[model samples]
Target: MKKVAFVVAAAMTCVATGAQAVDPHVAVGSAQYSIGISGFVPVICRATVDATVVPTQPGQVSLGSLNEFCNNPNGYEVYADYSPNLGKASLLVDGQKVPLGNAGSTRISKSNRAGIVARSVTLDLPQDVQSGSISFRVVTL
Candidate 1:
């Protein structure tokens, strides 16, 4: 009987210690709380052009690839502009002639959905405008 009593006391002591060891972060009858997290990525578009290459035709200047990137779900457009703004320069992409705007910028291509695209671009400059460069612009729609 004495041994059984000692064992019960020891078991009660262990249970009491274990109960005290549990520390709660929240109050006993209080409402629970939670931490919320969020993030954002802004809509963006970008265009990159590689180095100029020798033209296969005598009067045309061939340029390297024009790569485009856009994240807008609607669409994107690629434009081309030349240096010196020399009178109505002609822009060709993959051998197809792209119409020029009066403001000196022309839309070379467009996409209905967000994606990455690449195309070959070329320029036909006037004889008066020698030694010039071409630039590209990307717009998210």
Candidate 2:
């Protein structure tokens, strides 16, 4: 009887150990992971003039015309190439400078593409301004 009882206890221990071997799992329905992913364009513009030299007689003279193209969204400005004697002359678009002739720099137009703005510039010439050549430029604002 002692031998039988010992055998029965050993069998029970083996059964208990085998029961614990079953793996328990918790259900994972869904999983997700995310990452945030993350640039500059330089402001650029071009300007061209129809004439290089403009001759004036002392009253008002029209200096051919100029066309400007700008890639900036806010548009651009045209200015007479800055010089020491630039402000001495007056540039008129309609009747006066868009801003005011400080160094002959004035804001001419504003557009998204600006395409080709053919603007004729008129200068009220002082007899002192002798015959010469002038230049214009476009810049993004």
For the record, the alpha-carbon RMSD of candidate 1 to the native fold, in angstroms, is 10.2
lDDT of 2 by residue, 16-130 (tens): 5554454222222234222222226666688776666666578677766667777777767776664444446676765656433455455556665545567776767667765
Question: Which candidate number would show the highest TM-score if scored against the true structure?
Answer: 1
Worst 10 residues of 1 by lDDT: 26-35
Q: Report clash pairs, candidate 2.
A: none
Full-model lDDT, candidate 2: 0.62
For candidate 1, the TM-score is 0.60
Evaluate residue 112 in candidate 2 and report its C-alpha lDDT on the 0 to 100 scale.
55
Give the distance in Å from residue 14's predicted Cα in candidate 1 to where it truly belongs: 24
RMSD of each: 10.2, 18.5
TM-score of each: 0.60, 0.53
Give the whole-model CA lDDT for all candidates, comma-separated: 0.70, 0.62
Off by over 4 Å in 2: 1-44, 94-104, 112-114, 131-133
lDDT of 1 by residue, 1-141 (tens): 999999997896665555445533322223333333456889889988786544334356767788889999999998777554533567678888875545666688899999988888766665555454567888888
